[model samples]
Target: MKYSLLILTLLLTFSMANAQKIYSVDYENQADVKVFVVDYANQADLKVFKVKYQNQAGKNNGKWFFTKYANQAEKKIFFVKYQNQADLKIFFVDYKNQAGWQKNFKKSLLY
Candidate 1:
């Protein structure tokens, strides 16, 4: 019984540790851009990506996509483009401060 309890406790602890929250931000006005937030234990990474529009005739449709990866120690932001048509911009901010990176996204982007 004691061993079973210990095992259960360990499982729960591990489950909790593995659970992390990630955030993504996309705007209706700009449907081609994307932002991602990757969270770590000590740091986090913010990644941004822009999507290509099908028809660029009348209006420019660009959206921002965002996501967060939690529990990462070394926060690094990166952007990748395939055909050079789409671009991305990443920004990293501290996680501790109330008005820090995470909060900033929530307030600014309403995420």
Candidate 2:
């Protein structure tokens, strides 16, 4: 029973760490991740889909929910003017099914 409880706690912690509750910060220093929107999906590290509800957000799968307040967000991001300055390059996708990371190696950036 103790081992089961430990496993459950670890699972919950991992899920919460990958939550797509994002907040846009005004400055780069305030952000947990620096992002740049790419012109094309092929050029992107991740393809993002904006969700209307927080419950609809994905777990490191690129389905994002933009929180109104910074405190409400799981991850705070800053938009970089140039692609070179970004930690993650993303392209906004029209459909939720298309939202996902193209480069799995950079997945740790969100965590």
Q: Give the per-residue lDDT digits (tens) of candidate 1, residues 1-111.
A: 999999999986664343222223233233333333333422322222232221111111112222243232111223233323322233343321211232334322322
Compared with the true structure, the alpha-carbon lDDT of candidate 2 equals 0.92
Question: How accurate locally is residue 19 in candidate 2, as Cα lDDT from 0 to 100?
Answer: 66
In terms of lDDT, the poorest run of 10 residues in model 1 is 54-63
The CA lDDT of each predicted structure is 0.31, 0.92
Collision pairs in model 2:
none
Model 2 error, position 6 (Å)? 20
lDDT over C-alpha atoms for residue 34 of model 2 = 97
Give per-residue CA lDDT, model 2, range 9-111, as digits (tens).
9987776665689999999999999999999999999999999877678888999999999998989999999999999999999999999999999999987
In candidate 2, position 42 carries an lDDT of 99
lDDT of 1 at 59: 14
Alpha carbon deviation, residue 72, candidate 2 (Å): 0.7
Model 1 earns a TM-score of 0.23
